[model samples]
Target chain A: MRPVEVGHRGGERAPRSTRLLGRHELPIACEADIVLVRRKARSLAQAYGFDAFATAAITTAASELARNCWVHGGGGAAVVEELYDGTRHGLAMEFRDTGPGIGDVEWALAGGHSTTRSLGLGLSGSRRLVDEFALETARGEGTTVRIVKWKRF
Target chain B: MSPIPILRIGTTLLCSVHVELDDALAERLQEDVLGTIERTGATGLVVDISGLETVDSYVARILADTGRMARLMGADTVLAGMRPEVAATLVRMGFPLEGVRAALDLDHGLALLAHGRSGATEGRRPGRTAP
Candidate 1:
């Protein structure tokens, strides 16, 4: 579903607690899909009242995670949503794929590591851009990565 | 899939990445760039990323690798027109961008490439002087 676009003018609905606002699902299959995810992320972040710089950060993080899903996990889907925690709002992105799972979580997140031919910064770099990051994977069950970038004051 | 365009200007080959880059497109870009340099005998290459609103570490690595690849092919690579926010994001993400020379604009990029070419020429011919 599309995010509810409330204007910057106050008195709409204050997100009193952490909650999911809207969600968009995109299949991560090809290069084009990567661009699509980034686009969705920018708009979602903006709709949630994130500034340009904050929107950029959210887009970058989303792009990295989505690309990782496609490149490493063969293919998957991304869920883009607006989130709020009290007065602080945020953008949340989650990617899930069914492919060979990461053999070493520590190595993957440590920095300068990649199972495929990459700079090995997809996971690590994404973590650096956002306020929260979590990854889950099993040998055959697939992989899931969730990241959140809170809007800055 | 259409590859990003790499334009040839004077002795400098300019590549402006206007679209979001993916792994396959980036690989094709590298190949196309190397091929163009070989065919045109260009001595300089400039990669402009100002059109990109955001870039991830993978794209950053590709740019850096392309710079190194161009250097290996006897051409100097100059990156130009990166947005400040994008640069900051890359830095925060810890993308070292090793061996990539950056300039603020296309004109400065061309100048940097020209200067590097002249330096290389001078080094190749120890006694040669600019006329």
Candidate 2:
């Protein structure tokens, strides 16, 4: 998929930033994919001067989301993007799955909640780890979770 | 990978696992431990967990499965020398260690086993000489 410009204002006075940042897509296959996603997220975050803790958190969050995709969704893909203005800025990730969508988003976001016998900290912990988190799901359609973390450096 | 050392003293077998007990190692541990129980006719087995850094769900499940498999083979399995952090993680993750024993170290575990075996034998035959 092509990267679309978002967060643009509808005014002629505002200058339009046309810089395209890095984008990556990876397939979630098995439990090992979780670790791979974490590593990839860490590298992307570190490349943008994000603090070590922030990078570690992003890595853990990515691992959680990727694991959910593998275990619950059967398989999915992850998209990562780095955004910048001047000094290294922020990173965002989108995880999309074709598995059965969540029936209760609110309940699922609560900590220690899980349908399977997992640690039940996937979505909740991931949400807490990032600066911004959003989820969209439709019954039988699919689920998409988006998260963004800003650089502390 | 080096084979986990197994020491058989009478009816009990002491196993020293010198590796991480993560998902990958858990698979190998299950196979090796279960296979040992089947072949050696051990009545009890002790698994050393001092080398593990963490116990995730997969490894926890493997430990539980190993216990069940040992029982099926007529052997009881106990976990020994779990690091405090690993124990805390397992507890937080709600992995039950019902039939497994957690000891502070290998020496302590061996001593406990020795005491239990001697006590059991003394109870069985009061006048017999202690081996």
Residue A100 of model 1 has an lDDT of 83
Over the stretch B1-131, how does candidate 2's per-residue lDDT look in tens digits?
43667778888887777754434556777887777777888888788878764445545667777878887898766677877655654554344567665557776666555655655521222233458
Interface RMSD of 2: 5.6
What lDDT tens digits, residue by residue, belong to model 2 across residues A67-122? 78778888899998877645446787889998888887778876566578555777
Give the best candidate by TM-score.
1
Q: Which ranges in model 1 have alpha carbons more than 4 Å from their true place?
A: A1-16, B1-3, B120-131
lDDT (10s digit) by residue, model 1, range A94-115: 8999988777777788788766
**Model 2: colliding residue pairs:** none
Cand. 2 TM to true fold: 0.57
CA displacement after TM-score superposition, residue A87 of candidate 1 (Å) = 0.8
lDDT for B105 in candidate 2 is 77
Window of ten residues with lowest summed lDDT in model 2 chain A: A6-15
